[model samples]
Target: MKFPTVRHCWTAFLLLLASGLSAKEVPPPPDPPRLVNDFVGLLSRTESQALENKLVAYDDSTSTQIAIVIERSLEGDDIFDYSFRLAEAWGIGRKGKDNGILIYIAFEDRQIWIQTGSGAEGFLPDVMAKRIIDNIIVPAFRQQAYFQGLDRATDAIMQLGSGEFEPEGLGKKKISAARVIFFIVLLIVLFILLSRMGGGGGGGYYRGGRYDRGGGWIWWG
Candidate 1:
């Protein structure tokens, strides 16, 4: 009787890996009852209603959909993957526009993710999303101000979606321009130094090769 071949063993290992991955796939929660689904009871009834109303009005006016989901835990699944699957399953945005945003919070895992539809990515980019998480949400959550965090973060998202506010990076273009100017100036200075060093009398001369003058070696081309 011949033992299992290496190829057979490798194929068996791949199958086991696939089975493990399938086991870890967690099903998304049920369809959202409203724009805000706080399954963990993180928000009070009044707070949820107020947020829901605000989101409803925004959606009604702009037709851009934003949904918030707060789960007790992600059930040992990756938050990004779970959020992407959830957003896909829920069909959160308009069909053609694909302008949807899903703010997912895994309370027990202490992980939060913002999944934006293709159309919405232009307005709410990864940098802006990171800013919202770091500057607004995380700070408020750290102080146990979950409602405040969500409220402010959603407000920012709405402002971006509605074109009421520009992302912080917009202003950074000026800084980048200034840096370009600085880099140009630096290059000019380097060119001047190189010219002066290579221009003087017999001290330095270009011979289409490397030259050493007891000070240092310089390549001349």
Candidate 2:
């Protein structure tokens, strides 16, 4: 076979180089299913519903968007880099405000990233994001309580956006249903005690020879 000319060889080399450069490949684009996208099925239906409600409500009120993504793997990409790429590709926050928040979880890599938009950066700085992961998320992930971790972390993030969250309170661990129920019961008991103490002073404890206002012995005593 005859050898190729210099111009032909140069063209072939350039083409090959261009193809190799293109083949290097960028991160994949994001196609979010909804406000909460659980690709890995980490969240049950109920958990998903709870997060959706919280996110929807926050968005409705503040026009700030938040989304969750759970993936089995990041396809060998770094989670932090993948998170930024996904957030940018998804166009999550408002165009002008840039108030979007992304909660990205890669279970296979045991990595979590809280990606915030320009508006959110004021509330959720990189330092705060790391703290949320370390204090709120990693502990629950360690215990396999992904739902609790996400729920509380979302709440804390929302509180941050609202400017009501105290950095000192980050130390508080996840609150359990049982603890909530106990708090409700304790409040109810306190309310009853206060009501009994009031004892309807308009009419004395004993009126018209009957306990008109305070029927209980404790109230009278």
Candidate No. with top TM-score: 1
Give each model's clash number: 0, 0
- Kindly provide the TM-score of model 2 when superposed on the true structure, using C-alpha atoms: 0.62
In model 2, the number of clashes is 0
lDDT (tens digit, per residue) of candidate 2 on 79-148: 5445655776677787778788888887776767777776777787766776777777887888889899
Model 2 misplaced regions, further than 4 Å: 1-33, 167-221
Runs of candidate 1 exceeding 4 Å displacement: 1-19, 22-32, 166-173, 176-178, 184-221
TM-score against truth, every candidate: 0.69, 0.62
The local distance difference test score of each candidate is 0.71, 0.69
Index of the highest-lDDT prediction: 1
Model 1: per-residue Cα lDDT at residue 104: 84
RMSD of each: 16.4, 25.5
